[model samples]
Target: MTETVRIATLDGADSFDAYVAWPEGTPRAAIIVIQEIFGVNPGIRAKCDKWAAAGYLAVAPDLFWRIERGIELDPDVEPEMQRAFELFGLNKPDDNVKDIEATIHWIRREAGVPKVGAVGYCLGGKLAYMTATRTDIDASVGYYGVMIDQMLGESHAIAKPLLLHVPTADHFVDAEAQAKMHEGLDGHPRVTIHDYEGLDHGFATESGNRRDEAGAQLADSRTAEFFAANL
Candidate 1:
């Protein structure tokens, strides 16, 4: 089942909306589903549903609410793609982490969930890395995350398990950045990096022009295993 939940920001100034999917039975754990440049749209909601079917409570917050609430964009649409980037530029990463932390606290304090992990995609994939470094998230998984190479200095703060999926041919993330990511995070005990050769970005999106069944299945299975072992 799915529902809308409101989470008060850490500062108690205002609240943001989060789409939540509940499992049929009591949850084994909870996972925060971070969105891409898009907001909490169908693709992200479907991801939550999948996790719910697997017996985890999944919550996806509207990270873009501060700029414009309820945004659902299409990458195939040129104008929307450009707008998505605009929103990305305006969104605050540090502030987003606080909201994520608040979500974690809400799950633990209200729902009594012992372990709370996060899985993010696209821009969210990069936030997953930030979550690992900045928040107390139990575990994190990121797919085709961009600009991660730029944040290598913060890797020292990653205290929990983090799994990153990198698409080698991703136009958004170039070759040099990929190399730097491997070089920076290779030996980190809490980090695992997987490379998908020749695949472009969004290969694992639930449904879209971008989805690649084989790559999605492989990466998702790895994510499930990683969460099971870590969370």
Candidate 2:
């Protein structure tokens, strides 16, 4: 089953919408589906339903609600892509992370779900990494998370398991950044970085031209396995 829900922020003055999906029976765990630059659009909601099919309750929050009530962009459209970048530039990720924290707390307190994990793509991917380091999320998966090399200092706080999918050919994250990420996090016991040779960003998206079937399946299987083991 799928439904729309409202999540309360920590400050109590703000509340945002979230799209939720549930399995037929009791969920084994709860998975927070973080959105990319696009808001909780069809692709993101589809991901939540996919997790539901896998016996995990899933929710996708509208993190962009801070800047705009609803934002759904198409990567293939030039204008939308420009808007997405603009939204990305204007987005306050730190504040959005707090919304994720609130969502985690909501799942635990209201839904009675003790184990909660998160998976994200694009900008969501970066947030997932931040979630791992900042919050008590049980497990986190980031697919081609951008700008992660810039935040290696906080890696020390990552107590739970984190799976990062790195596309070696990602233009957004060049060789130097990837090298820096590896140098800082490769040996960390709680972190695992999987490199997809010759692939680029968005290869694991649920739909669109960016989706590479083989690469998506490989990365997704790894994500599923990682969540199963850790969450």
The numbered model that scores best in TM-score is: 2
Q: What digit string (tens of lDDT, one per residue) describes model 1 on residues 1-231?
A: 899989999999999999999998889999999999978888999999999999999999999888988899888789988999999999998888888988998899977888999999998999999999999899999999989999999999999999999988999999999999999999999999999999999999998789889999999999999998987
Measured over all alpha carbons after superposition, the RMSD of each candidate to the real structure, in angstroms, is 0.8, 0.6
What is the number of backbone collisions in each predicted candidate, taken in the order shown? 0, 0
The alpha-carbon lDDT assigned to residue 8 of candidate 1 equals 91
Task: Give the TM-score comparing model 1 with the true structure, all chains together.
Answer: 0.98
lDDT of 2 by residue, 1-231 (tens): 898899999899989999999998999999999999988888899999999999999999999998998789888889998999999999998998899999999999998999999999989999999999999999999999999999999999999999999999998999999999999999999999999999999998889988999999999999999989987
Model 1 stretches with alpha carbons more than 4 Å out: none
The top-ranked prediction according to lDDT is 2
Window of ten residues with lowest summed lDDT in model 1? 105-114
Pairs that collide, model 2:
none
TM-score of each: 0.98, 0.99
